[model samples]
Target: MNKVFNTRYLVHLVLAGLFSFLVFNLTYAVRPSDYDLKEGDTTSASGSDDPDVYIINEHGYKRLFLNPVIFNFYGHLGGFAKVKAISPSTRDAFITSGLFRNCEANDEKVYGLESTGEDTSILHWINTTGAQAVIDDPNFFKKVFCINNNEFNWYLKGSDYNSVNQIPVYSRDTTSTSTVRVGIIEFVPQNVVYGDVHYAYLKKTSGCWLSSGGEIGNYYWVSGSNQSIHSSDCYDILETYSFLDIFNNLSKGISKNVQRTIYGEEDTMETLHSVYYIKDFYEKEALKYGVSDLAIDIDVKGPYMLASDPPLGGRWGVGEGVCNASLTEFFVNEAISRGVDESQYDVIAYVYLGDWQLSGRSYEGFTSCATGSKSFMTVTTWRLPQEDEGVVTLAHELGHSFGASDYYTSPCPQNPTLWSCVKDPEGIPEPNKIPKYPQTKGCLMAQIIAYNKPGSDEAGDATSISNLNQAVICDATAREFGWR
Candidate 1:
């Protein structure tokens, strides 16, 4: 309240005695089809005198990012590709909505912008004592507007918090993961619907994460009963069931972005196995990868797999006591000892102790339980510190682990009706050296997939593999797992 107001350049107005606000009614018609800029992506008018960047919201609306401080506010949302330049025509394709960037240095006050028209909006100060924040959906913040002290003079003065038509803020369990919520929303098309992408208010106790509204719950969104709602209905229908008590209530398994449930894997402690050597590094890098995974259905769950010491002992790095072959041998031996069901579509993840060369490796297929690997994956920290990230390298390796039996076998890919590593002594000359998986032609990173390798180009790798969450499963591999 002590801060000086910058009302010299702007007029102070209080309308209707309850609300005062700004109007940014852009008249540009939208094609929707012309929108290539997506949510979480920031774009500005190409070569403008005064470049104003906007992050696309879920409904394809563009909200003013305000300034650098506001843009950095949601950096927990992971990344922005340096404010891409879009044509002025392309930029106008989306309607400009109210601002959602936070203006307060503290959580003392927050504002919500309710759209009365395609352009007109009214601001309301959230001042309710028990008014729980609508963080169940991150995108909800996109539609709302946030104002600073200077702009505060130009707006509504009363605490008119409308309870109905409520919004869902991005929610997460403060226990299981350190991921934060953001106002980012992907601009999903209107014609299509999505069952994926959900958020839930969760808590953890006694080593189990509990969610009253998620995939297995009766909630409208996570249960797939009404994903068509798209985080609407004000979330009143959600968080309805509270069973934080009773031994039988806690969720058995939980995948993330809120809910990517993976049950029956008691030992899938994805982060713990890599904590020894990469502990400090893993803690920092893993979060970005985890948040990034929220965009894709495949969220980063873990480096939770077999390693040299693992739970049985201490930490070890690649080429320390295990090379590619020896590591596979160790993993196979562990699987044998653990009676690991190879048919269960199981994968063992190995990580770098401190740092190691050969950044990534994964067994393509199972030959025999005793002879070949149990489809284990290894992600080293070698080249990660240079440019690529450790979790990203792990994602690439995990993609290979999720690959189908057809990748390394005699059967040709159904989509292209062809195969790589062609058996032509006349061309490759050393066709025999090319593994049956045609690994030399790339794709199957059976033992190792390194940046140091001479050639590392595959369609899936080029498009989606390295990204934590970008697209669904790609070609040269089954879109679905073999167990499915």
Candidate 2:
């Protein structure tokens, strides 16, 4: 009886072991297909030839996993799948696929996970902290998932994707109107962009006319004439006079030191004029207006010859006087070549040795004619004038550059009828009026030529007389220039 019982017990033990083995095989077979995947085999979870380790749900719309997950999961196994490591470029492609839907109806969220070779055990914590955390915190989503256009293939927040190559795929707002949309992703064109080119040229003329009595008055033939209009030849008179002589004569009587009280404080300022001598009239005038400060400083340049033949008009033609435009171009070019910074000088004064003409009349001088606020060039014919007329002319022209207009009443050569109707036609109320006129009578802008009649105060050797009183800027003129 003991031997039979022992044999029975051994058979029962064998049967029990077989039954346990069958049950284990059945359980393994019935398990999910994804769980049965081997290290070397690919899983249908990601639809790639990489072992799947984690399942990612796209807001209940689609489920997928990254390719690198397989290599990262079974890295310790000798037969683990051989896959490339995840890169920024690959990660961008996954984000741009548009397979992931918005996690919330009104909220757009994106999340990304990077693998650590040490162990995927931390992946289990993803349920409580990974994608859900990104969805909860918009800042975290932007920091980790969103990237600039230059860094990724898609446009994220603040990414400039408005070019033709990159087209926007997302709406700017949660509205039905497509008017506001995000930029798209495209390659930047390899081409250069250019801006508009600006070119300017001065007007050309054979000759210019100078009016004796301002813009509108008695006309005298200065240039392109054989006979002299004044007692002394205009050319000879201009050649004999010197700017230093004129400066010394004009500066006489006027105090170099000035005192003023501003903001309850007495301030004294000394004005100094540093004069520089040049060889020719053009250089002198150029340096005067170019280097000489409006309030101080004076310098001389060269007696350089004309760059090219002067653009003069035909003999006895309407354009027989000096072309102010041509002279301006010539002087400007010379200053540029001499290494003189044109920008340094706020004003340009052209002192011609001979009389020039403008607007069909002969004149001693003119200022701010051709170019208005731009480098206000004062063209003065250095001919001998009666009394302190030369000095007055110089002061008057310079005044025009300093926002003073001619106060004289003269009809516009082009529109005589209209100008004649107005009370000081030459004095336009505008700030930078071309051929500005004076608002007051007997002011410098009104009459630069001094008179020495019996009743005139501007008498004597003319050189000794100071025209400061006549040429001083008026209150209206000062107001126009914003000098209250």
Candidate 3:
């Protein structure tokens, strides 16, 4: 009987120990600290006036706390508020507090607070303190915070913050053309950094512009057109000109037969014919829209020889195949020396020393604009043409001078897959910010060859002027040249 009692007692002791272990493990798993409050969870609050405060992550994910006391720092907030990322390394977490208030018409204060290490842990806090928040942090809190008071208002008007950094806030005066606005919000890194910043002016029932629901980065509340603050008025017509540079190799004799053979014609007046051909082409194309009376007076010069000390690429060296900026400059200087006025002409075409039949290649053309008002266009050819390709090439180069964009796809620094020759992704379009036409296959902007192959027998007929299929200038190009 004594042994049986001892065995029963030992078994009971073992059972009791197991029960205690299970209870401890279960309690730990459901502890208050272990519970993560995701977006949209309603919890009781301690300091929050609304008794409901939500957690907004860097990516703008919102969650309601299971226990409001966990995030006691968040309270009833009015005015503008946002969250942004503080550090680039930990973009997923470590958000900065972005809060601001417009107390009066001439007084405002911006506040920024950020967590150091972890999101829920809240290891350290960095706060923007003082009369006005300094634009000294790597976060968006400094960038977006502002007061609407006179002093703060003066700062917004005087400072060009958008020129240096990306700010998401737009003005409450929707009709106003100003680019900047005043507000304060937390720095939620991911929200502030990567995508397009959007903002909208809500027409409140009170007939006031309500700058509410402010965000750091892209938000659905902001409309696309509202995001664009400035657009230039493109209504002025450009006075354009064409300067032709005809190259004659000094080594070759200036015989009628040589000129005829080089120009692909039996006429002795090769230069005259070429000039007339270009003038007629421009007149026919430009007169259709009445953009400007096409004035292309051509001056053909140069039976000049290449310099012995060719700078680079052996260009203009006896018979070497080369084309570059240096060569283009050399040709431009030659044209000027031959009495072609620089101010008179906006476009230049250069025909150089090589046979199109033997080389069958043309150097691409470009435009340069120093004053930002008008483009100086230039095209260069290594050899004279024996086919319609010469006229096509010349027209293509002049197109650049006239603010026409190229449709061909080429690798660029901004976009590696493909980039337009005319439109820059970084800033507004040159000449005007007119929308570029959709790239059409085999169009004049896309290629130099005539699409319909009209006037196959005539020289200079492969251009847009003669070929109906190749003659279409996109609406954007038309607007850029003030044709529309």
Candidate 4:
């Protein structure tokens, strides 16, 4: 009887050991918490009384876990089943609050026997602590970091609790709108300078008109009686005949700077029909010279109204102003039809003071475009004989299209007494000191080139006209519009 009893006791002990091994393995396979259910979501489990406990936290997560009864009694019954719910915001708070730093903390063991490996032990610790954390604060177990309670308090206290670790947001009025915007247009001329208030020299400068070979040639008789309409054409003629010829004859000017055969040729067509075909080509060329990548097509509905009553106030006069306004409007309408939205383009009428007021100051060219209008428009004015001044006038007017400020100082009392605008120590600037307008010379607004002055230091420097400088002009314009 004693032998039989001892044998039965040994069998019972063996069975108990088997049960312990099975339960430990089963727990290892239990699913963890999910934290991705949305607010107001309900989840159901195999044996849960309430299926509405699942909720997603701010960070969006969900998890599954063994039900309490299954966690305890399932091992006794040799069954494995669990409940599931969305992780809550408390987990996020734990991480943000510095409760646990990394996976190492999550791997700690809390209630269960600690595993030998550090990672496994910590995971076990966190699994148990997570449940307790939820009990302490229903939303506390949202993140893995929150599984460790001691670390959270320690971080907050050490950081003074006032240090904001997250980005803050501010609100602005969202419904505000404006019906109208304002704009302005101005010009720069040849051979101007910019300086500081203390007369500390800032820069010597040249205007766009001067740099582009404008106002450098004699007037051409289109009809041998009619004057040339385009100012640039006249400048080109002078560049070809007067400057190039003289320079070429003296000291290899032809090879050194003129590039006569390659650079000095004009359009070969003598007939009006031929000229018309290439009109757009010429205009496009001019636009490129102005440093704009976006080209404007020439709309020559008719010849520039140079023959109108009272000579149409050539270039920037009041009559020219009216004409410019009309042209700008026409182009603006076309752009709008081609899918450009309102306010995308501004049109300004550039009017020189002499032209608008009929001051008979023909040499003092004038032009204006509508202020703040994205579409460019200008009625430029020049002398009665505009042929010789094409380059200067055209470049001056185009400068406004690129948003350059005027370097010319008006006698107005309210103007800023800034050093760069006017009053240079060297008696007005000659030659462009800075290549780009802003922070360089007086800007395109001053519209003056170095050669215009007698005996200027930079008088012979053609390097200013290099393609690099041209590129700068194009670059600056592109930058203003946030383009390449």
Per-candidate TM vs. native? 0.23, 0.29, 0.28, 0.24
Candidate 1 vs candidate 4, lDDT winner? 1
Each model's total of backbone clashes: 9, 35, 28, 74
Tens digits of lDDT, candidate 3, 357-405: 2233332223321111122222223222212234444545455544565
Put down candidate 4 lDDT per residue, 1-484, tens digits, no spaces.
0000011212212322221100011101112233333432323432333232222234333221212331232233233332333222222111121123333365442221122222122122222234434432233334322223332222222111111111011011111211111122222222211110010111111331223232332122121111222233332332122221221122211111122122443212111111111222222222222211222222222111121112233344555433354544544454344444434222222222123223333344323332232323322222211111222233333344434334444441333332122323221322333442122221223433222222223334111211111111222322232222
Give a tens-digit lDDT track for model 1, residues 23-124: 212212233345655665677777655466776655555665544555666665444557878875455445454434345644455565554432234566
Give the top-scoring candidate (lDDT).
1
Model 3 off-target regions past 4 Å? 1-275, 309-325, 336-343, 356-389, 411-442, 448-469
Answer with 1 or 2, whichever has the higher TM-score: 2
For candidate 2, write residues 157-178 as lDDT tens digits. 2322111111112111111210
Candidates' lDDT values, in order?
A: 0.31, 0.27, 0.29, 0.25
2 or 4, greater by TM-score: 2
Q: Name the weakest run of 10 consecutive residues (lDDT summed) in model 3.
A: 178-187
> Which 10 residues in a row give candidate 1 its minimum summed lDDT?
180-189
Query: Candidate 4: which stretches are off by over 4 Å?
Result: 1-293, 304-370, 374-392, 407-445, 451-484
When sorted by TM-score, best at the front, the candidate numbers are 2, 3, 4, 1
